[model samples]
Target: MISHRAPDSLSTWRAAILIAVIALLVSCGKPPPKEISTLDKIRTTGVITLGIRETSVPFSYLDDAQQQAGYAWEIANRVATAVKRDLKLDTLAIHTFVVTPQTRIPLVANQTVDLECSSTTHDRERERQVGFSSSFYLTGPRMLVRRDSPVRDWSDLRGKRAVVSSGTTAELALRKLDRERGLDIEIMLAKDIGENFMTVETGRAAASVQDDVILYSNIARARDPSAWQVVGAPLMREAYACMLRKGDVPFKRLVDATIAEMARSGELMQLYTKYFASSLAVKGGVRIDQPLSDDMRELLRQPNDRID
Candidate 1:
C-alpha cells in the first residue's frame, strides 16, 4: 500500500535536482564518435575516385571508344582493387575524374580526388602539397620538331618559338634554360598535349618541348610518322609517381606497397612492354614504339619514392 502525501514539496524538489545531476554525469562520461578518415569514408561509401589525363597517351588517356585506357590507368585500377580488398567490401565502385596538369594537385590536396597515376612528375616542390607513391617511370624533357628542321638540340632553339604544355615540368625546365642561356625563345603555352603537338604541327611553333616518351607517342599516332622527330638527349631526368593527399600515412603506405609488389613480381615490366613495345588498341592500333630505358629498368628493380 502506497501513502499519498502533499506535505513533502521540499523533499520532492531535492530528489528531482539529484536525478538531473546524475543524468548530466552519465552523458559526460561517454566518449565522442571517432572522426572519419579518407579510408573510412571510402569504406563507408564503397567508392574510390581516380584522376586521369585525357591526352597523356600511354600514361593515361581516352581511347578511340572514349574509355580511359593507358598504363597508369591500369595501375590505378589495381590500386582500387587493393582498396576494396583492404576494406573487405563486397563491391567497390570506381569513379574517374579527368584532371589536367593544372588541376591535379588541387584536386588531390582538397580531397576531391583520391589519387592520380598519370604522366605526373614527382618533385620536391609538389611534396609540399601532396604525397607521392613509389616512382613508376622516368623520362626527361626533349624537343619534338619537324623531320627536316635544323634544331637538333636545346641549344638550337635559340631565338625560335617553342610550345610546351602549360603547368608541366617541361615548361618550367624550358623557361629556366631560356633565361640561363639567353635563348630569347618565344614560349607558347598550350592547355594539353594535343594542343601542344598541334601547335608544332600547324607551324605555329618551331618545336614542342615535352617528355621524350610523349613525343614518341605523338609521332606514333601521327598520319605520317616520318614527318616528325624527337631530338636531343634528355635535359633533366624526372621520376613519374602516383600522387595522393599529403599526410595520409595509411593510404600512402598501401599505395607504396602495391607499387613495390608490382615491381618485385615483374608485373610492372609486363605493363611496360604492353604499352611501350606492342601496338596499342587506341586510335586504330597505334604503337608508342619506345624501348625500355636503363633508368626505367633500374626503377623496377628497386621501387622507391626519391625525388630530386
Candidate 2:
C-alpha cells in the first residue's frame, strides 16, 4: 500500500506528531459507518455511485471515451435499473469513479461508492471489511509466463520470482504457499493489474500471477501476445462478486435478489454471451470465451455472498 505525508510541517513538530498519531489510531484502516443507508442516500440524491476499474478487461473497464464497459459494467447497469425501479424513479443518474486495486475496498467501506461493479472476488478475508452480492463469476489463480521460459507448472517455477497485484487473492495464496511448501519464491507486488503484467513482460519477474481470466485479458493486450503463455494448474478457487459496505443488509438483499432474478430469467446468460461467448473486442481485444465451468454452473443454482 502507498502512504503519503506532508513534506515538512515541523514548525510545531510535537503537536503535528501527536495529531498524526491520533488520526492514524482513530481511522485504524477502516472507515466509520454512515447513518444513512446506501440505497436511501441514492434515492434521496437521484444518483448511484459506481466504482469501476479502467484495466479490468471483460469485466469493469473504460473504453476510449472513458465510459465504463465490459461484463461487470453491464451487470452493474442491470443493478442500477433494479435500483431505479425499486426507488420508483424513472431514471437515475450514475456517478462513476475509477478506482485502483488498492483503493476499491476502502472506497466501498467509506461509502464513497454505492456499489463497486468491478471484478472483486468474494473471499473470506475481504468479507471482514465489506459486504458482497451473490457471486457473479468464478475463477482461479494462474500464471502468465514467457513462451520460451522453461516454467510450465508449479514445480517448474520452484525458485522463480512471481509478481502479483498487492492485496489480491493471488498474492495471498502465493504467500501462503511460499510459507507452507518452503518454495522460497521471491514475491513482488505491483500497484495494479497493468503493472503486474509489466513486471513479468519486462523480465523483471519470472511470471505474472493473478486470476486466470485476468491474466488472459492481459495477454490479449500484451505487446507481443505470442510471447507469453498461461501455464500451470489453478492454485485456488475464487468467486467474483460486487462489493458494498458491510451491515447494509437491506441493500445487500436487494442486490442479491436482483442478481438471482437475472440468473433465473436467463438474462444473466445473455450477458455472459455478450462478453464471453464471442470474441471480446475491448482495448485488449482477445477471443477468449470463458464459459461457465461446471462449478460455476452449480454456483448459479445457488448464489450467496459466502466465499465457501
Candidate 3:
C-alpha cells in the first residue's frame, strides 16, 4: 500500500460531504414544515379544532354527555361559522378538545388547537405566549366565602387561608396583595377554579378568590347556592377572550374583525342575554342563571384586549 497524506482541501471536502449527507437525511426523514397560519391549517384540513374547558362552568364545561358548551364556546362557534364562511368551505367540521388552565397556554402556543374557546383571560404576560381575540367578557377578581364567614374584605383575609387556582390572575393578584399588604394571608393553591371554590366548601380554606362571573358559575353549580357569598372589592379587571396562536397577524385581524362585526350587529349581546342573562339548562338539567353585568355590556360597547 502506498502511504498517503491528506490533501489541502481534505477538511473542506469532509465538511461538504457532511453537509450533503445531512441534506439528504433531512429530505428523507423530515416532512415539509407545517404551515404556520391557523387559517391556512383550517383551509388545508377542512376542520377546526376548538379547545374548550372541561370545567370552566358558565364559560366552558363538560356536560353529562361530555359535550362542551358555555357562553365562551358559543362565541367560539360563531367565530367558527365566520371562519367557514371566510374560507368558503362547503363543509368545515369542528373538532373539540379539553384544555384546563395548566394546558391551555401550551396548547395554543404549539397550535395543538386552532383556537382556545375556554375562559382564558387576556393579559400582558400571557400575550408573550399566545394571541387573544377582542374582549368577549369582562370580570374582576372577587372572594367567595361561607355565608357565616367573617371575611368581608381583604383586611379580614389577614392570617386566613385563601384558595385560588394554580395558574390564574386571581392567584397572582392574591399573592401580590399578600406581599404588599403583608396580610399574612395563607395562600392555598387549587388545581382549578372548581376546586378553588371547593376548598372553601370543604373548610380547608376560608376564601376562594376568582372572577365574579366564575364565582356565580360555581354558586349555580353548588349543592346549596345560598350557602356561599361572593363579596369584597374587585381585585383586578380581567378581559376574557378566545386564545389563539401568536404572531399570526392575519388570523388575529380576522378574529378581531369577527368580534367587531358581532359587536356592531349586536349579535354578541344577544348571545350573552340568551346564555347568561337567563336561566339556562346546564349539565344534569341544572338551571343556572348568570345575568350579564353592566360592565360586560360596556366591554361589548368598546371591545378591548389590553391587559391593563
Q: Quote each prediction's TM-score.
A: 0.83, 0.86, 0.83
Please, what's the RMSD in Å of model 2?
A: 5.6
Per-candidate local distance difference test: 0.89, 0.82, 0.83
| lDDT (Cα, tens digit) per residue for candidate 1, span 104-145 | 999998788998999889998999988898889999999999
The deviation in Å at residue 263 for candidate 2 is: 1.0
Q: For candidate 2, report its TM-score.
A: 0.86
Q: For candidate 3, lDDT tens digit of each residue in 1-308?
A: 74477465689899999999999998699565444799899999999999987667667876677677787888888889989999999999999888877788998888788898667888898888788888888888899898999999999999999998887788899999899999999999999766787788999999898888878878878999899888998898888898998878788888888888888889888878766766555656554465557777787877767666
Local error of candidate 3 at 263, Å?
1.7
The residue-by-residue lDDT of candidate 2 on 141-162, one tens digit each, is 8889998999888767688899
Candidate 2: stretches off by over 4 Å: 1-11, 21-35
Q: Considering lDDT, which of the candidate structures 2 and 3 is the better prediction for this target? A: 3
Give every collision pair in model 3: none
Candidate 3 — which residues are off by over 4 angstroms?
Answer: 1-35
